[model samples]
Target chain A: MIDPVLHAWGWEIPVYLFLGGMVAGFMIISGYFTLKGHHKHSDFSSFYLPHISLFFLSAGMFALFLDLEYKVHVWRFYTTFKFTSPMSWGAWILLVVYPMLLLNTLVSIPKSFRNRISIFDRISDVINRYPALVKNIGAANMVVGAVLGMYTGVLLSALAARPLWNSAMLWILFLTSGLSSAAALVHLISPDKTEREVSAKADNGFLIFELLVIVLFLVGLVTSTRAHKQAADLLLTGPYAPVFWGFVILAGIVLPLIIQLLAVNHKIRHTPVAPLFVIAGGLLLRFVIVAAGQASVIP
Target chain B: MSSRYAMVIDTAKCVGCMDCVVACKTENNVPEGYNRDWIVQDVRGTWPTLHMEIRSERCNQCDEPPCVETCPTGASHVHDRGGVVLVTKELCVGCKACIAACPYDARFIHPDGYADKCTFCIHRVEQGLDPACVAVCPTRCMTFGDINDPNSQVAKLLTSRKWHTLKAEAGTKPSVYYLT
Candidate 1:
């Protein structure tokens, strides 16, 4: 029946989780900017990045679909709501993402862009008539974004069998990492000088916090049962160590973090390499956790 | 009281012949390279102080089955008949959440894309027959009955013997018990 860990989830899941986390990160950043009225000056937050989230989300969903053994039964996720089921909650949460995205897009874009589409023009006119509602939508985006980010990690921790993922710290680590990675992307692409510095500063803080969370995560496992200790070893000294320590930690976290910190302090100029490393590290974080968690046994 | 089925295996008597496995495969039409039940030989201690415990294991049919709880769809559910966990093939997306949630490792994916596992032979049980595994167990080490009934053989064995369930710390409250 169980065959130990089953190891059913593979690369597709990690890729999907990574993209989902990134998409959540984008939502939070866009939402924060919209609320602060920074959207008026920031093209990346208002027009481009939010729309790019849609494309990334679609790609993630496609990867998820590919992993399903019974693709036709995918619709069954909506047939009923199992409150205890994280997958059920994740499916419904994903549904909310699209409408929230489109609605926010209608209100956040510049007048010139909205004027290009007649339908968008009418919708934005109706939506813009109430600035209060627009503000509320901005807040909703951040709330939903936080939930999405948490869901990516919560689903794994919910599986008590896998000791590697059975920690409350996992979701916090994921959320911080998501935010930091989003900030890195913003810093890399945003044209506005003020916005670029603000995001880079935020990223510096997030990276430091993320590193702390990662330590707490490992500590949580090592201090628990022997089963959990062995699970931690999968990342620490086992087969997954090279990638977890080498790619995700050293290259992904430490390298980019040092670069971003220097850039944030104005000691050095921002380079594309650091942001690229942050994004790549964010993705590898998911893959290593998913794979290592699958390899962990209950016994 | 509602019927609560359970399995009690006497590890002291079991020889790990795996008759229960073959019978289960054949009776349930289980595909090759998969099983609903199997034997586990746990060897503890070192060289001269070795202690081997051979027991037949299957789905714990936990009262708090995480497989059913974590199932994205309602595919993995408990049967009303005796709280037996079963999956509806049509509803399973095979996302493998149930597979990961279960610590007992009592489930496997059917090549047909459904989460397949020991069903306690509910069909045969309904006909007043034991599960295929229990019936074919060569040592007669396996006992099957409703643990809810205080007078049932399983309940009596569990009450009288030194028995333990796998992953007792997991809080799954498994229905299967092993008597040492």
Candidate 2:
């Protein structure tokens, strides 16, 4: 029967959110780069984007698997996709997004037809048959990536059980966080001058958006209609307090903001440290927010 | 013929003995570490002001089944004959999406690594027998019947008593009703 209490969640749920955030973040950043013409004739696009997308997607899938009671049976999700469930949406997103990313990876091989027939010819000639199609597919992947990023927020926000996460603002917050973290990771791994400049602008835009969303999220928490105010208390002083303040607020918000400010002001070089710090902050932010949202300590 | 079957539970008579829980596990041959159905007991405060209540929670077998809708490969589907939700293990790719989608935590991963949950004992019902839980409930707190049939025990109870479903706000429209 309907009870006058919140439904308790398992630890795996939070981890699932965290991983999803990361994957979405990476996909967004990668998409942003593609939009800005980062995936031109450079071998970097061929080598990095697909591989990284696969890594993040696989990581999120693994986290989802770990969240299950019978994790080994997780494959059943592939065999089973229900339209009414958010889990189904996520699975569908993965199914579409991952293959698109893989396609980008496959076409990167210059000689696709040769690879198919020549087993030895790594770059076959078949991809040339559909160059226009391949490019369109690349663009599609970016769009899919952006949608994937937003869906993570929608996933949690759709769960009415946890009032703290039940806001449309979550979609914006998660998407911003995802893109910011993705840019941060890119800045850390590759120091390409052109990519770095573009990433910097994207980072600035994302950081500003995230800061606003965080404020709005907190406002929602404080002014909740029900016992949701407890979530605010949890964020401020409960088990998630240290995480919220330390990682989300301090490292994620403050540190990144500071680094961006210094870089914009010419006070600091665009060194690896700043972006690395931002990446760390972003990852930590996801971890804490996810944890905080799932924790229910109403007595 | 299509039928909307249901379970009616009388929480007032439940003694928290977990007999139904055990019976469900044994009847379904549920995995040792996992339970397709179980009881959740909430007791507030210490001795003096303490209030105790036990809820036998399982897959609500909602009319709008989220698990079935989320199954990408059609592994989980509603049986049109009895409106019972069933999971086809052979078709299941083992994706835990259904588990996450189900708000009740009713679904669990089976030993064979497929999703499984309470099926309302369709097999037993086909044999003209009550569900194992209904047969084994020492307090007779649980009842199963065709809500469509006015003469069914569940129909009588629904007409006579106030009942509720868990997480009704989720729009799952669960068939299982509880009288607290």
Best by lDDT: 1
TM-score (chain B) for model 1?
0.98
- What TM-score does the predicted chain A of each candidate obtain versus native chain A? 0.95, 0.83
- In order, candidate lDDTs are 0.88, 0.70
Candidate 1 C-alpha error for residue A164, in Å? 1.2
**Tens digit of per-residue lDDT, candidate 1, span B1-180:** 999999999999999888888898899999878888888889999999999999788889999999999998999999998899999999999898999898887888888888989899999999999999899887899999999999999999988999999999888999999998
Best by TM-score: 1
lDDT of 2 by residue, B1-180 (tens): 356788999989887788887887799887666666677787879989897778777778888876777666687888875688888787775555566467676766675666778888888988988888888999999999888888889989999998888878777889999987
Model 1 has an lDDT value of 0.88
Q: Residues A1-299, candidate 1, lDDT per residue (tens digit)? A: 11322437988999988888888888998888777777767667856777888998899999999998888888999999999999999999999998877877876667558568789878877877888877877788889989999999999999998899999999898888888888888888888888888888888888889999999999999999999999999999999999999999999989988998888788999888998999999999999999999889778
Kindly report which residue stretches of model 1 are placed more than 4 angstroms away from their true locations once superposed.
A1-7, A110-112
Q: How much DockQ does model 2 earn?
A: 0.23
DockQ scores of all models, one per candidate: 0.59, 0.23
